[model samples]
Target: MLTSIKSFFSNELFNTEKGSTADSSEHQLQLACAALLIEVAVIDQEFDTRELQALITILQTKFNLSAEECETLRTLAQSESEDSTSMYQFTQLVNSACSPEQKFELIKGMWTIAYADGDLDKYEEYIVRKVSELIYVSHSEFIRAKLAARP
Candidate 1:
């Protein structure tokens, strides 16, 4: 699965810019974002269908991915999130690659997933809060994102 993910990132996603550092960075950024979303979705120990749909929508809209691409990303991100020791690995990449606005949007996406099932678990909120802090999103922005994403 890891090899396939690497192949997809290297070949399908950034084939146009192969061998470039920027391509590598972009691939990492995409994976990181997807992994973070997966993290939030699974934090409550139940990956709801609603959360899966919300995650797919976020990846498709935020990364401009097609359905197939989104599926591939979600699979890879699930694997990555499961094997990962902590959220910092994902959040660090986001902090370095994304702008403040992008980071805010990411927090909102996390919130969206948390609320997708019509219930927000405490662990889910904690994971989102931790990611927001790691990515340097202000406390006010975090609250704002939560409010904006509440459905």
Candidate 2:
């Protein structure tokens, strides 16, 4: 799995440029964010079509990615989320790479996915809450994000 992730980063996600640490970091950030979103979508064990679509839309819009790039990232993230033991790895990358506002936005995206099917599953909400806490989003801000993303 580690080798697959490394190959993904090296071959599929970004073009290799000499000394391009920024690009590598950016791709890692993208993968981390996508994995979190995927986690929310699948936490209920349903993986609803609406949730998948919402996740794709959020990834494309937030990352400014082309459709193909978004799909590739989504596939990789889904695999990572399923194979993972905890959320800490993804959240750690996010905490290191994202600003406070960016973290809040990610919470909003999670809420969006949670509400995508027009029902808020407890497990979905719990995962979102866990991620918010891991990312150091205040309780108030987490509530604000949920309210704002409520459709």
Candidate 3:
């Protein structure tokens, strides 16, 4: 089943708008950003309450969203993160569209999420570092944010 999904995604026939079910750019961005956070939180497979709260906090502050809006995005992001076969689709979109500063902010946000529990797990560190590199965040800046975000 996974192979088939990958094949379908990789095929040229899947390139069109009709090829996949989800085509909403805005929705995809939200899902991608949120899911990436969730993914990092779950990289350790702990998915603790602190991480969840941190995710909600990040969403609320960054989007300037109300509680309802925060929950909506969180739910959508969680659903996608749980089911996603790959994180690249969303990361690629963010990389192409967001500014350098925004990318740096995202790295900061990822660090914030990782430190929500007051302890930085190995998996969380690995995930955020990898994601920071992918998003073009400098190593020093990434380290600084990670340290600052630490509880």
Candidate 2, 21-87: lDDT as tens digits: 7877887788899999999998888989999899999998999988888899999998888888888
lDDT of 2: 0.91
lDDT per prediction?
0.90, 0.91, 0.74
Better candidate by lDDT, 2 or 3: 2
Looking at candidate 2, the ten consecutive residues that score lowest on lDDT are: 12-21
TM-scores for every candidate against the unseen true structure: 0.93, 0.94, 0.78
- What lDDT does model 3 reach? 0.74
* Reference-based lDDT, residue 36, model 1: 94
For candidate 2, the per-residue lDDT at 95 reads 94
Cα lDDT tens digits, model 3, 70-145, are 7766776777677878777768978976787777777788998888888888989898988887778888888888
Model 3 stretches with alpha carbons more than 4 Å out: 1-24
State each model's C-alpha RMSD to the native: 1.6, 1.3, 6.9
lDDT of 1 at 39: 91
Off by over 4 Å in 2: none
Give stretches of model 1 more than 4 Å off.
1-4
Order the candidates by TM-score, highest first — what do you get?
2, 1, 3
- Could you tell me which residue pairs clash in candidate 2? none
lDDT for 45 in candidate 2 is 85
